[model samples]
Target: MNQFDTSITFPNGVTLKNRLIMSPMTTLQSYYEGTVTQDEIDYYTRRVKGLGAIITGAANVEPLGKGWQGELSVAEDDKIAQLSKLAHSIQSQGSKAILQIFHAGRMTFPATLSGEQPVSASAVPAEHRDPNTHDAVPRSMTNAEVYATIDAFGDATRRAIQAGFDGVELHGANTYLLQQFFSPHSNRRTDEFGGSIDKRYTFIEKTLESVFAAVDHYADRPFIVGYRFSPEEFTNPGITFEDTGYLVDKLVQTKLDYLHVSLDNYKRVSIADNYKNQTILKYLHRMIDNKKPLIGVGGVRTREDVQNVLGSADLVAVGQQKLVDPDWPLKLANNADDAMINDEFKNAIEYTPLNAPLYDFLVERYGSIPNI
Candidate 1:
């Protein structure tokens, strides 16, 4: 490998060809039952030709836990077989395969969950409105239900490993299930799972412990475990960089293999805040020590940005940038001059009202659309 080569070797001896990971994007492309289709396999395999590991779209663990209408799921035994096939397709190209496991919490729409209200740590609704429908109120998860959800996450991890995934990523960021527990604005519970900082962290601690135990017992290979966390919650009274640093300290002591850091939970900001801006990446680099591998994701678009962060962090996650060009990592690694993105990819990266119409047409014909 060259000196500037981005390939990284995980603890389990899986060698990533490059440090560019395809971050999970909820593209509403899977079937209603969340089965991976042939088109889905082809979409992911095309991206794996020149990337490191392909982190799959967030796979919901429970049906009621799903956040969107067409979100993917690995909650059932039958789904595992198709997911295994998806993993095999990526592995055939010599790329590691990992799945992002998530529960959308208050972010879930009632229509998505069969008219059942979405659940969260408390009765707090997501600060933002649903893209499809304008609703504010969301249901809350009971203490016992929270515990059950934690177990569900562990079960999902076991299922992912059984399906031949190299590892699983706990979706702790983006104001989802774990983020709902961590944010004071979202988690209003006064019980042990809420209140003080330590109390709020209890859910994540327990979830991580359960997931690690599940992998230990069920996974045939030494599965890699990691969490995607917000370096700074952008809402008022939300988690700050310092709070995330403390969380990182606790997580580093666990069996986690990497930390995927990003910014989320904003009440008011442009869509760019959710995707662009390199400031968050710099802050994340400053917050974390050199203990575990740190993966940074934001508006990173160029090779120079990749190299700058690579000097400090272990990996650079390309989200919208890769949506335009599946060969992004290869182009950067080879130092191509005309690697600038085109209009199509740029438009796809941004949120457009027409996306829904286009997606509806694609799903009708393809049976599923590939979430970037």
Candidate 2:
């Protein structure tokens, strides 16, 4: 049997049909208030072929967590109906649906929050990717607000259960709220939630506690819980590979169903000088010690690419490639590489499942979508 066709089961006893998973990719297709739109549902439903699971784009746990316009929301009970539609659309097609939940924290803009300043572990500003753009300095989250945000995560988890999702992946990566607390660059608090590395981890530890509690209280069936984190950061005083090792070690000892390492390439090496020899994926796998499945994703497109990533981790996730061709896994299964979308079909409105906004976002980021 082909390597990609192999099945894997999580510690929660949830089995994935294959090794392929659709990474959570934001489509900017949701309603302004973050409600799931029909376009988003159709897009995910069309991508279910031959995949084990699909993790929907990050859904904020609170209104202030909105990072940008058109982000999906699990912030309130009213959004559960639309979220249920998204989960059903993916699960009905034989693929597990996992909702990626998060809080944008300091990564958002004032305009996005209706003039309210973004809040974080501290009043620091995040570094913008675009050198020319200036990031707004955020206010420190009050102790009361900090506890409330943690509770918000718990509420979000309950909403996921009510919406019928198979799991929820905590968005602890991409320098979002979770990462902000873990990052010394953003978290300068002297309280219990900051100062030492272990202290900084308090927020994450507590957040996990809240999430698992929700599962135990509301979920009548097995539900997977995963954590995604960046191995290292580029800013000074940022999280290092050493720091990530500590975090991963602690996470592995928990009831987490899986650990996902976010990267631009699955085989990419650590940005830190001490761990540059081996890929971060292999290092994380070693730290996890096979206690939980490790998902490796970044720029994966072809069969060879998937195999290469699988060598280091238990699962391979497809991001940009899945967007380019929703049948990415299906094409690989059928050995129909030539049938993958080409330039002509890429622009064909009838052939593409992406909504207009998503198409514009893709074109603006990647010069014409590449083959999946």
Candidate 3:
């Protein structure tokens, strides 16, 4: 049997329809104020069909956490009505809707956060999303702010449950706040949230503690929770291969639904001496072997690419390819002919929601997003 055609149940008793999932990709379709727009609803509704689960673009858990212009916001109780619209849009198509939650940390702009200085583990600066404030230096978050962020994550999860989402994926990857705390290069503090590798994971552990507590209290039926992380960093003394393994070990023990390894190429291996030859996905797979399922993503475009990733991971997720072909999984299930697949690109323009930043991003940076 084709691996993609099969269903798998997680330890949480939540079962996916098949082994294909929709990876979260920012559409830039929300209101600048962070409300879910009708266009955004239409955008996701088109892609949610046929996947086992669709993880929505990263939504900020607090006002100061917004990373981009159109990022979705879940920082307050009032957002539930609009969030429910999003949840209904995806789940109505029979696929599980999982909201990915995040705090941008130093990746955000001061203008985005209403004049507040961006907060991080330290007063470090990196390339940010806004060109105007690419050089903005963030302040170190106080201990109270740290705990409040953790609480915000829980409140956001509870909001997800109330909004009718099937699950939530903690956005701990892509150099966001969670990864910032875990990276030695970024987290040079001497506190419990930094310094040692074990201590670096304390924030994530506490965040998950709050998340699972909300899940236990709010979810009436089987709900899934997942965590995504980038494997290693290019910076010196940043998250090393060993550090990633250690973090994954701790994450798997939490008994979340699955662990997602973020990669630019699923087959890309480490250049570091410690992890010589094997692909990073395979390296991480070994660490979580028999412990929990892993979701692999990267340059998965065609059926061949899909199967290649599934070989390394329990399930395969698509981001750029999903933009090119929203109905790709459904077409594969029917064994649709090449003519149908080729016609997909022509229809893709309709599926890809139009937003100025998303349009420019597709055209400029990721010229790989096919027909835009």
Candidate 2 lDDT, 177-230, residue by residue in tens: 999999999999999999999999999999999999999999999999999998
| Residues 1-372 of candidate 3: C-alpha lDDT, one tens digit per residue | 239878989888988889899898887878887888888888788888788889999999999899988889898888899999999999887788999999999887778787788899888776433435544788899999999999999999999999999899999998999999999877878888988888888999999999999999988988789999999888776788888889988998895999998888887888679787788987888889869899999877777877888777899988876776777777877877362344343345445555666666666544464422
Pick the lDDT winner: 2
TM-score of each: 0.86, 0.94, 0.92
Which parts of model 3 have CA positions greater than 4 angstroms off? 127-134, 337-357, 367-372
| TM-score of candidate 3 on Cα atoms, chains taken together | 0.92
- Candidate 2 lands at a TM-score of 0.94
Residue pairs in collision within model 2? none
Which segments of model 2 are wrong by more than 4 Å?
A: 129-135, 341-353, 367-372
Q: Write the per-residue lDDT of candidate 1 for residues 25-139, one digit (tens) a residue.
A: 7666678888887767777877787677888889998887797766679888889988999999988988789999988888777788887878889887666664344355666
lDDT (C-alpha) at residue 188 in model 3: 76
RMSD of 1: 5.5
How does model 1 score by TM-score? 0.86
